[model samples]
Target: MQKPLLVTDFLDRARRYYGDHEAVVATTGERFTYDEFGERADGFAAALAERGIEKGDRVGVLDPNTHYHLEAAYGAMQLGAVHTPLNYRLTPDDFEYILSDAGVDAVFADYEYAEKIEAVRDDVPTEVFVTNDADAVEGDWESFDEAIETDAGFERPEMAEDDVITINYTSGTTGDPKGVCRTHRTETLHAYLVALHLDISDDDVYLWTLPMFHVNGWGHIYAVTGMGAKHVCTRGIDAGGIFEAVAAEDVSYLCGAPTVLNLLVDYYGDHGDVPTTGDNDVRVATAGSAPPEAVIRAVEDDFGWYLSHVYGATETGPLITTSDARRFFDDGSSARFGVKKRQGIGFLGTEVRVVDEDGNDVPQDDATLGEIVVRGNQVMDRYWNKPEETEIAFSDRIEGYYHTGDLATVDSDGMIAIRDRKKDIIISGGENISTIELEDTLYEHDAVADAAVIPAPSDEWGETPKAFIVPASGDPEAPGTTEEEIVDFTREHLASYKVVRRVEFVESLPTTATGKVQKYELRQEEWDDEDRMVGEG
Candidate 1:
């Protein structure tokens, strides 16, 4: 007899086999066992059903990484309701667009984000509003605690593997966000892949640094939970908070974007104790922007943490490629690890290819750049409520494969190096500017903390490169670098055309909830009121 592979299977397994295991350690210092976690999830499922939520209905959750958020997510899935994790950091307008686009039925918001939800609640036809903290609630929202206090469990809905389980909206830097619908099959496969890549075990103590709303917290919720690993939840991102959690919880694994890693590296270098707890190395998996080679080295060599790089999008379940260079490079030299930092190759169930404009596979020569395309179990079902957009997203330029809109090159060793986004590539006076290449070089500088390059409007060259920088060790009141100094730094490393012509010093770059620098927003500000740079034919 073939057992059905569903997310509920994981929940049931954990409850039955690992019932006594610690499932969640809340930010409030409360703990729950696997049995208690499963019961709470089931109780929430019943509660959701009482509010008229049924199979295939879209339920949105807007909260940080918390125990309630995890329970709400699993509960919605169990009841066959599509879990749409709202980016809590998004503006009200962004929320309006997403809620209207997804046709969300009910929203489970944290007390902190109740205001944002209330602001956009009128625009959305959402029936039920559930908030985590009762005292912090607004706009007639029900308490999440009260809802889940009932011990009754709802009957698990009959769901096929291909049924839509989640609708993750892309961070709308370019335009109105598109909801990427992922099925149970894709989610299950993604969890398995992540578990395999991270080498998760029952003994592993996984901490939640990445927000659960972001690609199901990089799919760790399922991966770690399935392995019956201890989950340590963080309320927010603070250097002291992370340090305290790591030491107190004895965290074995955590995932973050490059921005998170940079913050940790900086924090640990300044204040953290060295030689992490007797061979129990804290392993960090980061994606989004690739970490600079220096950051990677500092994390592993200086901090004694094993850092792995992964590359994927929200639509692809966000676990496509993992850099497992330790297997290929036994020497563990800085150079060998540096090679692994360039995105690397696809995961077990994924196949990646670099294709030219005509969709022909590009050669494995390091210099030949092409568009990155991927196909795998984790590929999203479609963009919800946007068929034309979904069609364009899947086969817009690549014919059959889902076009990543990312430019990359394959090395002789079959490793893939992400060059830049196709839209983010800067062309000035017929010279192409690789923003990623430029950003990588700029990040290597001691003064620069983070950098993003975008094409600025130019009267002479048609378009010029503009660099937005966040300094490493500078007073916010005094950045200490002129435009000429930054331009000179770029000139020393890159060619004249690729050098940053405009420089903007800011405390921080605009980022997505997942910590990706929103370069599209920067481009929009630079090209606003000009129709010439819209990439029209």
Candidate 2:
């Protein structure tokens, strides 16, 4: 007999087999077993049902990497409601847009970030508001602790594998943020691939350094939980806290972006004698952007932990390719860093290809630049409420495959390495920042006449936004705006990560004969000292 692949089965299996095992190590030092976690999720589901949240309702979870996020996500999923997670780093305006766009019925916010949601409560369509601490918030919010203490009950809704259960919002590249709808089968199969590729097991102690809001923690929320692994929760990213957690909890596995690895490397450089691992063998997976080979070398040799580099976007599973191919390099050899530096091979059952504009495969000569496209079971079904955008995303330059908008090259071994970005998106500190948005924001300032934003090489962030501006006065020397002022203006309007860190005053922006701004020239000028415009590797 065949079985339907549902995301709820992950938690159910853990509760059935590992009920007595410790499942969560909360940031406050509290521990909860699988049985206790399941009960809390059930209680949350019951409360949602009481609040008129039906099977197709959208539930928003705004929290960090705390146990509350896991509880809220699973709780909504159990009731067949869409699990929508919001980035805690976003501003109140962004929150308003996402909440209104997704039509979120109810929201469960962490005490620290509930105020942001409360600021936009009157603007959104959400009816029920809940937070971990009702007293800390100055709104009509329900306390999560009290809500789960009731005798109310909820029933599981019969769901098909193709029913959309989650909606992850993209970081508004060209316009308003688009919700990427994912179904139960896509999530479940992605978890299985993650488990198989990352070598996750029940005995492994997984650390929560990556934010659970990022592609559902890049699907680790299901992969690790389904494996019955121990989750070591964290409030935020701290180098000292990370090392301490590894030592204290005996963490065996974790995942992060290249920014996290840079932090660890810099921290180790300052404190050379810090502990890097615990009793179990440590395996770290990195995505978002490729890490420099030097960083990868230091991680493997100095930190004594294995690093696997993966790649994908939010539209895909956020992990369609990995660099963990052990056959390419011998164990403990220096050549492995070069192999791992590439995005490497596609995951099993995932078809990743470097294609030209004509929808034909590029040669595997490792020098031909082509756009990376992918087709997999883990890819999203469609964009929420945007059929035109969905059609363009899947049909642009190819048919039935998600266009990553990332340029890469394939070696003779079919391993792909990213070279440049096709989209006007700057990936600073592993967060996507749309250059068009920054340019638009700059145009709002009275001192700026013309502006173009590009990715500049950042040693710490891997990539930082650099803006070239033409003064309204038509004189570059006496521009009305200061570099610091432009940066401050962006911080006030946009998210912190999307702020432009570097600014250059110019008399005229490089433009084509047709009067269009030539951003490629600006990028080349900004990244002249770097190996590639994309990232270090």
lDDT of each: 0.84, 0.88
lDDT of 1 by residue, 1-537 (tens): 865668777777788889998899988889999999988888889999988999999999988899988899999999999999989898888888888888899989899888987997888878888998867766788888889987666787788998889999887777788899998899999999988987999889888889899888888888888888888988768766776677777888888888887887888778757434333568888888788887788777876678888899987888788777666675466676666577898999688889898888889998888998889998888988789977887786576578888899888878898998988888888777799989988887777888899888887887888888888755535666677888898899987778888888878899987889998888888888798554321
Model 2: how large is the Cα RMSD against the reference? 10.7
The list of candidate 1 runs beyond 4 A from truth reads 151-153, 272-279, 473-477, 534-537
Q: What's the residue-level lDDT of 534 in candidate 2?
A: 81
Compared with the true structure, what per-residue lDDT tens digits does model 2 show for residues 470-519? 88767889998799999999999999988999999998876421123567
Give residue 445's lDDT in candidate 1 (0 to 100).
74
My TM-score estimates for the predictions, one after another, are: 0.96, 0.82
Clashing pairs in 1: none
Angstrom error of the Cα, residue 161, model 2: value is: 0.6
Superposed Cα deviation of residue 60, candidate 1 (Å): 0.9
TM-score of 1: 0.96
How does model 2 fare in lDDT?
0.88
In terms of lDDT, the poorest run of 10 residues in model 2 is: 510-519
The candidate scoring highest on lDDT is 2
